[model samples]
Target: MKQELTELLCRKSFKYSEEPAFKLVSGRMSKFYVNCKPTTLDPRGMFLAGHLVFDAIRTANVTGVGGLTFGADPIAVAAAFASGLKDQPIQAFSIRKTRKDHGIVRWIEGDLTPGQRVAIIDDVATTGGSTIRAIERARSEGLDVVRAVVLVDRQEGGLENIREHVADVSAVITRDELVEQWTATARP
Candidate 1:
């Protein structure tokens, strides 16, 4: 089941899974790019990943799931839906790159209550800067961010930085493993 979940996520995240010279949001030459919308926008991929993520966080006992907007949005939504299916629906939220000037004037979105345990999600992690900011916003709102769940970890310093605060992180695949599998299977 776990292997199946990983395979589907790899196939669906084609932007990163198939490309090798993606220009990352960090302005660095990423070995790959992870545009998870392809998967999130697909029903099968979303349901599979949602169930897997929810089960993964079962031990974490998280009250909410969220992270930086854009990439993490779909994953957070999926997890929240899975939680609902399990009859333990969890709150979902997001962190914007910058706070909107009008209306809410908040950097963080969703129900912003204090002291909730949360798990952060993202499509991919390379430097962890964005993830860190998300964590900061959540913490500032008094959310106790317990762990991070990423679709892919680029096997760079990103995981290290996140671990400084989260200690334990979950990912569907690492850069090394993804390349290894793709190389072995990608048709010529």
Candidate 2:
């Protein structure tokens, strides 16, 4: 399953460049990019993502899964959706970058409450800023962030930084792994 998902990501989402390396949100430059949305939003990608995440958290017994919106939205929904299919439903939640200022006037959306155990997730972790922010928000809301997970870890100190706050941190795949796969496929 892991191999299948990695191949899917490499074929459907990963991109590489050497001339003007890809510019990252963190202001860093890289020779490759992993736009997981193409895969995460795909039907098969969604299924694999959800099932993979469900398997990762199955033994953890977290009440919910979530992270910063946009990036984490589909992944969280997919996982929650998969969990339900397995009869062990876990709720989904999303955290906004800022408060709505109107309506609910809150930062978090969905059926999340204080003091629940959740695993924070992100599409990719370059510097871990977004993931950490999500963790901060979760903590502020009184939720216990038991795990930090990402679809891809760029391995650029993001996971290491994340480990400073959360004891358990992991990624489904890494940038290096994708690069290797991409390189292999590119060969004659």
Candidate 3:
């Protein structure tokens, strides 16, 4: 499953260059770029990602899975769906980038309550800033963030950085793995 997902990402989402040509969210130029939405939104990609992420957190005893919106949304939903299919039944939640000012104002939107155990997820971790923010917001809302998961680790210390907040941190795929698969497929 991992192998298949890697190939799909390499073909549909991962991009590479001999020189740093891609601008990251952190405003840094990178030789590699990955926009997982193209892959994560696809049926097969969703299936692979759902199963993989669910496998990663199924035993963590978390009642919910989620993270900052947009990037983490699809993966979280997919994982939650996979969990239900597998009979684990974890809920999916989304954290807003801006605080809601309306009635029942909160940073998160889901069927979760204060103190519910949950895992934070992200599509890509570059500086771990977004995931860290998600973790902080989750904590602020009184959710117990026990684990963090990255769909793709940029291999640029993001996971290491995330580990500081949550001891249990993992990535389904690394930038290196995508690069390797990309290189292999690019060749004759």
Candidate 4:
């Protein structure tokens, strides 16, 4: 499954070049970019992602999974659904960038409750800002963020930065690994 997912990502989501290099959200130019939307939205990709995430966090004893909105939306939902299929049945949540002005003025959406262990996740980790923000909001609500996970880690020091606050952090695949795979397959 891991090999298959890596290949799919390399073929469908990963792109590389030296000239006119890709621009990252962090405002840096890069030789490659990974847009996980294609993979995360695909049925097989979504299945593999959920299972991989569930496998990573299942040992953490988390009751829920979530992260910053949009990027984490599909990931969290997929993990939650996969967990249910596995009979673990974890909940899913999303952290809003800004608290709603009306109603409960909540920062998190979904069935999350205070004092539950959760694994925060995102489609990709560049600077870890989104994951950190999600952690902040979750912690504010008294949720224990036991682990942080990303679909891909750019290995650009974001993981180290996040480790300053989070003890457990992981990425299913690293930028280096993807690059290696892409390089290997690029040649005839």
Q: Specify the highest-TM-score model's number.
A: 3
User: Scored by CA lDDT, what does every candidate get?
Assistant: 0.77, 0.88, 0.96, 0.89
Better by TM-score, candidate 4 or 2: 4
- Identify the runs in model 3 with alpha carbons over 4 angstroms from their true place: none
Better of 1 and 4 by lDDT: 4
Q: After superposition, how far is residue 37 of candidate 4 from its true place, in Å?
A: 0.8
Q: Please give the ranking of all candidate structures by TM-score, highest first, separated by commas.
A: 3, 4, 2, 1
TM-score of each: 0.87, 0.94, 0.98, 0.95
lDDT of 3 by residue, 1-188 (tens): 99999999999999999999999888989999999999999999999999999999998999999999999999999999999999889999999999999999999999999999999999999889999999999999999999999999999999999999999999999999998899888965
User: Cα RMSD to native, each candidate?
Assistant: 2.5, 1.4, 0.9, 1.3
Off by over 4 Å in 1: 15-20
Estimate, for each residue in 1-188, the C-alpha lDDT of model 1 and write its tens digit.
45665566567664443445777776767557566678776787788778777777867878888889888888788888999999988888888888878986777888757888889888778888778888888887788999888777887888889888788787776777766665666777
The alpha-carbon deviation from the true structure for residue 71 of candidate 3, after best TM-score superposition, in angstroms, is 0.6
Quality of model 1 by C-alpha lDDT = 0.77
Candidate 4: where is the Cα deviation over 4 Å? none
lDDT of 4 by residue, 116-146 (tens): 9999998888888888999989999889999
List where candidate 2 sits over 4 angstroms from the true fold.
Answer: none
Q: Which residue pairs come into collision in candidate 3? A: none
